[model samples]
Target chain A: MNKMTRQFEGYSFIGLWIIGFMAFSLGPLLFSLIISFFKWSLLDKPVFIGLKNYIDMFKLDPLFWKSLKVTFTYAVVSVPLGLIVSLLLAILLNLKLKGMGIFRTLFYLPSVITGVAAAVLWMWVLQPDFGILNYFLSFLGIQGPDWLGDPNWALTSLIMMSVWGSGGGIVIFLAGLQNIPQLLYDVSSIDGATKFRQFRAITIPMITPSIFFNLIMGVIGAFRTFTQGYVMTNGGPLNSTYFYALYIYNKAFQDLQMGYAAALSWILFIIIAVLTLLVFKTSSSWVYYETERKG
Target chain B: MNIFGKSVTYAFLIISSFVFIIPFIWMVSTSLKEPGAIFAFPPQWIPDPFLFQNYKSAWTIAPFQQFLENTVTIVVLTTIGTVISSSIVAFGFARLVFRGRNVWFAILLASMMIPYEVTIIPLYVEFKLLGWIDTLRCLIVPSFFGAAFNIFLLRQYFLTIPYDLDEAAIIDGCSTFQVYWRIMLPIVAPALVTVAIFQVMNAWTDFMGPLIFLNDQRNYTLTLGLNLFRNSYLTEWNNLMAIASLVTVVPLIIFFIGQKYLIGGIAASGIKG
Candidate 1:
């Protein structure tokens, strides 16, 4: 092929993506930033009111702070808790035995029933009066709290629900676990290390990359939490579950404060970006890559 | 491992798996119970007289048929667009030598990190300007543009193919497009299937996209339809479970059929990251 044809062929392959990136991804991103400066409800022409929306978010909107508190609290609690649960699940399921696949599948089944369906099912599961969780708790002579109804327990309930849906994390960790060389365990065993010692020395360090991956993703996912609060609590029990994303949704769709919502979303974007960068910065200390040789 | 250790491991696994799957069993049990029987003390594990009528009522009482049609339209079209467009773009990044190829690929990777919530409001406004609000096109059109994740996935798969294969194909007078369409696509079939399956699940379970763009009852996706049902029929536990099960089962069925590809995709995403 001539140079012209070769270049054309190459560009043709990527042309669709360039168009898509410009139109859908880049364009909307920049436009949302622009809209953050203007006071535009759907009906009105955008009026430039540059810093008011951002300033008001910080000073005037108490719900903005409230939503941030709720979301950060959820992320702080849920992310580590979810990491521990999923890692443990991965360890147990890593046993090289017959019928392990069935157990893995059963464990993963709940995550597939995600989004609205999962949210609705948990609403019943966390129902105050006749929920299966409370009913099951009764057998142990413990009274379960009114989970989604009480202000204190509502966020906790959502966190627990998130743990149950940590099947995706489990699968990821399992893959990471399997990647660990059996030779490491063999060497540790030969050195007369205890099982716990072997795990701490060999297992944990090896899976730190997966841990790091899940932690970053988990933080981002937790910050974007909306459907659970929207569907189950309606951000209620005195705005206890008023997540940041839910606040954004209500601002844009319910209150029709498009400009304010745009600003809220930018704040959220900055929070996530900063948090992700912080994690990436910290990853060098803990995350172990197999390719990196010890100096 | 010793017998005691083996037995303990088995016991722990069985117990945890039961705990994991119990809610699903509860959902099914609730869906089949008589409406009054749902709150039965000690919670009837199984319905004595199974109420199959709940499913019928959930389906009949709403415009579920229309909802299903709307969902199918969006899922099918988006899946096709995602598979074809993503792979073609991926082939370019993997094989075709071009100026700024690495830069473009880097830009694409960076774009993936931008959260969907950031651009959603502006996109909604853009769709409204195009008069696509309350329409399925708003949901479907975006997929025809290659998704970053899907393109990245297929690009990985394409790069794994030996370059000699492409060289031979080119020497045989196959054009770049022909090489991608014929040789490269088939070799990367697994990745294509993986992308298609992920898109189907994403489009199927997507609540926010439809919520933002689709306002008309006639254009409601299954996620929107189920949310509406939950709101209007707050007290109908049996019917609610039935409809929830109906919505949940489609993806469950799809997962079962595409279990290998789906799990492979998850593992690839984690490990590659």
Candidate 2:
């Protein structure tokens, strides 16, 4: 084939993506940024009010601040908790033992049951009186908190739910663990390195990239938390669970503040971008790339 | 490892596994309980009557059949669209050396980092303007354009295949399109399946899309239908559990069936470039 036709075929192969990217991703991205400066409520004409939406968000909107606080708190607590729990689960499952496959599958079962179903399941499990969690707590003579119902425990309850879904992360971390060369551990054992010492020296460094990967993904997932808040709490019990995404949903859909919601989403975008970049910036210090080390 | 240490590990594994598995068991057991028996003290691990009738009631009480039809429609179409389009796009990136290929691929990668919330509002407006809202087209059409992650994944898989095969096909007069359609696609069948399975799970579980796009009750997907069921049957614990169990079990079954590919996709995405 001539170079011209070859080029045409190449472009044709990727043509759908180009159109989709422009229409779905790039175009809307720019549009969202533009509308963030306007004051449209979807029913009226948009009036460009540059920086006012942002200004209002920072200074005037109490729910904006509340949403930010709630989102950040959840991200701060859940990301690390998820990381540690999943990492430990990965390590445990990584041990070559009989029936490990069943245990691994059992651990991962919860993650597949996502969205409204997971929320509903947790709601029943954490029900104040008849829920199994509280029912089990009674056996120990310790009263379980009114888990999704109480303001103090609503966020905590959600955090606990996050742990149950750590099986997804466990699978990723298990893959990372298995990627480590057995020779490293074999050599360390011969050199009289304690198991803890070898793990600290070798295992930790080898999986740092996976840890870094999970951290960024976790941050993004944490900030975009919506379904649980929407279904389970409806951002209620005094808005304790009013996740930022839910707040955006309410503003855009319920309040019809499309412009304001656009601005809010930009703030969320900036926060995620900055956080991910910061992780990337610091990753060089701790995230050990085997290829980089060799080079 | 010492026998004592092995026993401790076994104990820990058993306890943790119980914590994970108990929710599922609780859901099923609760689904079978009579409504009055749901609040029985010390929570019945086994329902007294085993009221499987609740499942029938739950299905009949809502438009669950309609919901299932809608969900299956969206899932099947989106999976087909995503697999075909993403693999073609990925084939171009993996082979076909064109000008600005690297830059375009980089842009695609960067685009994946942009949160869905960033584009959702404007897309909502655009879809509304196009009269796509309140319709399943809004949910299914854009997927035919190719997703960044799936494109990236299939591209990686494509790159792993030897160039000799493509060359061999081309030397025998297979056009680029023919090579892509007949030869390269079959080689990357496993990756295509991975993408298709992930897309199915994604389209099935997706709540926000159907929530924002569809307003008509008849148009609601399973997730939205499940939410509506919860709202209307707020106090009917047995019925609610029955419906939730039904909603949750589909994905559970999918995971069990596609366990290898699902885990492989997750691991491959996590640790690979």
Candidate 3:
């Protein structure tokens, strides 16, 4: 009887959490999937319309394609650029230097200011007129294009801001870099490997796991880019920054097209799911696991 | 390393640090400058008059005190709820040998990847049905259920504690709850603190949740208030900067003080994956 009571008590500890998961996470997910097949306008009764939302998203909606293009462009461009820049920063910081901790802290500072403040700060930084970026451009005897204001440059400006916050990636890469054994480098140097050769041969292969992790995360994160577009441009200057999440937000809240918005979000979920699966499928080709080899 | 290589590395680090640090310095400078001096060519690094009243003006322009109070209430409640609920669920997952535990744990891990956008529509409708719209409950209640990431983090920490300790406690007449509360909780206090910090930062800086769920100005969190303030006071650059700077102070202080745990948490999640 005591054992039975203890067992029941142990299981009951997870009861509230299970209830929450069902109501908030899983229930909502399944409900969204169902509502995507219906016309749910928040007031009117939801009418069943099977696969019409998906068909419209694929065949009829221009903004769907536009937003997808914007999201993909941002993701494809920013992820690689962010990866290289952060890895470079990590490599630089990995150099044995006094006060490297201070530099690391400074680099990591911007990522901590993530929401509206970061968005507002970036708006001023990338302001076309009387902005510091343009002010600095004048010294080069060149005219700076309107960054967030220009149709052609708006998305690019947001990508630049995204790169600025890759400081978190730097911290992650720094941790990965430190995990690499120093003996490997010493052996490479003894074998007359140049510094560049050592990096290409040693650093790149060893840190590929971190790279893979960051790549997957960056793609998911970039696809859902919202706050910056919502704040800085509002998908403006010809919808140049009409990202997928912004579109979903507008459709659901601003336009009251909750059913269609639900459909769009499900499509995004599938896209990320497929992309992540593809990365995992291909990870075996490039991502080196030290344990796999040793074991 | 060679002397030439070392100098090049130092030079790169110093220049990059300046690049990273300049925007913040500029923010503080702009917050203290008069409106007329803000757009001055070859911008003044320092305000001539140092108008500190911009913060006061910024405060009065918005119901910032109310926003702060709302944010504090939300952060404190969410943090406590997250810590308590996540620790409980994590203990069950880590210590108990229940049927279908692995399947449930896997489902929990998979839920982390489902974007908030996928669930926002129904979640909004659900909250509306519950009459939680425009209230703090929409934000705080969901947090009490335990986040997947925090649960996962704490579970990993809990798994490191020896099962022998639980057996010993059981032999000493402690119930399962006692083993969890009196024994495991104190042992995993560091992990609990880590979860609390992450939850506080998350609740404090959360923008999308408040934007979606909140309708009334009185119910706005600091992030929403700052965004609304920016929209209404587009030309008031000094005041905008002042408010933005003010909104950043809590996260900045937390980041500075608990950077080790913060970075360690990230590394743990990233590398273990």
Candidate 4:
């Protein structure tokens, strides 16, 4: 009787959490999925319009395709660039040196100053006439483009800011680098392996898991790039920075096309799911796990 | 490494640090400059005659004090609620052998992938039905339920605590709730602090939540307040930068104070993932 009572007590503790999950998360998720099939606005009753929202998003919407392209381009360009830059920085920081922690913290600062503050700060930083970026460009004898204002450079400018803020990835990669056994590097050195050779052979393989993790996360994060667009550009300079999330936000809230926005979000969900699944499917070939190694 | 290699690394680190820190330095510089000096040719790194009044002007231009008060209330409530709820829920997952625990845990993990955009619409409708649309409750109450990432993070930390501690507590006639509160919670204080810091940062920097839900300027968090301030004062770059710098200082201070815990928490999540 005592054991049974304890079990019930334990179950009830988690039961509270389950109730919350259903009410806030799971229930809302199902509601959105259902509403994606209807024509609902806040002021009107939700009219059943099965599959039409999806159909319109695919067939009728040009901005949908444009936003999709913009988001994908961002993920593709930013993720790889962020990965390579962060990995290089991590490798540099991984060296046994005094005062590396200070540098690490400085590099990681940008990631912490997120949202509207960072966006506003960047607007000034990328200001064409009096901005620091153009000031530097002039010194190099190269004319700088109007960054956030020019349609040609708005998205590129966002990507630049993102790469600068890839400091979090560097920290993560540094942790992964620290986990790589020093013994392996020592053995490689003893066998006359050059730094580059050892890096290619051992370090790359060892840190593939971290790379993979950062890649997936980078993809997810990049696709949801909203604040910069919302705050800095408002998805403008001719909608060049109109990210999918920004588009969805405008659709649902501004235009009051909640059901259409729900459909767009579902499409985004599917794209992310497919992309993530593809990465996982391909990960087996490259991701090296020490515990999985067999003689 | 040799002297040449060391110099190369040092040079690279210095340049990279400059790139990372320049915006902040420039922001502070611009904030202190008079409007005439702000757009000066060959941009001023330092203001000749510091307009220290920019900070004062920035504060008065908008209801920033009220915004800060609003943000602090939300952050404090959410952080405390998240730490408590997530830790307790994580304890159940890490210690208890409840039925369907694995399935539920898997569901928790999977829910992390569902983007906020996917849920925001219905969540808005739900909050509207509850008449929570223009209130701080829309922001604070959902966090009390426990976030999936925080729960997962705490559960990972909880698993590291030896089961013998729980067994010892149970042997002493402690109920599971008592074990969680007395034995487990104290032991996992570091992880709890980490969760608190992350929650505080999230609640502090949250833009979309306030943007969507809070309709009144009086209830606006600092982020929404600052964004609206910028929209209204498009040409007042000096004041905007001043207020932006002021708003950003809180998170910077938090990062500096909890530097070790924040990095360790992030590293823990990354390595485990």
Candidate 3 chain A: worst-modelled 10 consecutive residues by lDDT:
A1-10
List TM-score per model, in order.
0.98, 0.98, 0.97, 0.97
Worst ten in a row by lDDT for model 4 chain A: A1-10
Q: List the residue pairs that clash in candidate 1.
A: none
Scored on chain A only, each candidate's TM-score is 0.96, 0.97, 0.95, 0.96
Best by DockQ: 2
DockQ of 4: 0.68
The digit string of per-residue lDDT tens for model 2 on A57-153 reads 9999999999999999999999999999899988989998899999999999998888999999999999988899888889899899999889999
Q: In model 4, which regions exceed 4 Å deviation?
A: A1-7, B270-273
User: Candidate 4: which docking quality band?
Assistant: medium
Clash counts for the predictions, in order: 0, 0, 0, 0
Work out candidate 4's RMSD over C-alphas: 1.5
* Predicted candidate 2 versus true structure: per-residue lDDT over B1-273, tens digit per residue: 889989999999999999988988999999999888888886778899889899999899988999999999999999999999999999999999877788889999989889888889999999999999999999999999999999999998888889999999989999888989999999878788789889988999999999999999999999999899888835487888898888887788888888888767766564831
lDDT of each: 0.89, 0.91, 0.89, 0.89
lDDT of 1 by residue, B188-227 (tens): 8888889988998999999989888988899999889888
Pairs with backbone N, CA or C atoms under 3 Å apart (clashes), candidate 2: none
Estimate the lDDT of model 1: 0.89
DockQ of 1: 0.70
lDDT of 4 by residue, B1-273 (tens): 899999999999999899889998999999999989999998999898999999998898889999999999999999988898888888888888856789989988888888888888899999999999999999899788888999999998888888899889889999778999998888889888889999888999999999999999999999999999988945488999998898888889998899778768877664622
**Under the 3 Å rule for N, CA and C atoms, how many clashes does model 3 have?**
0
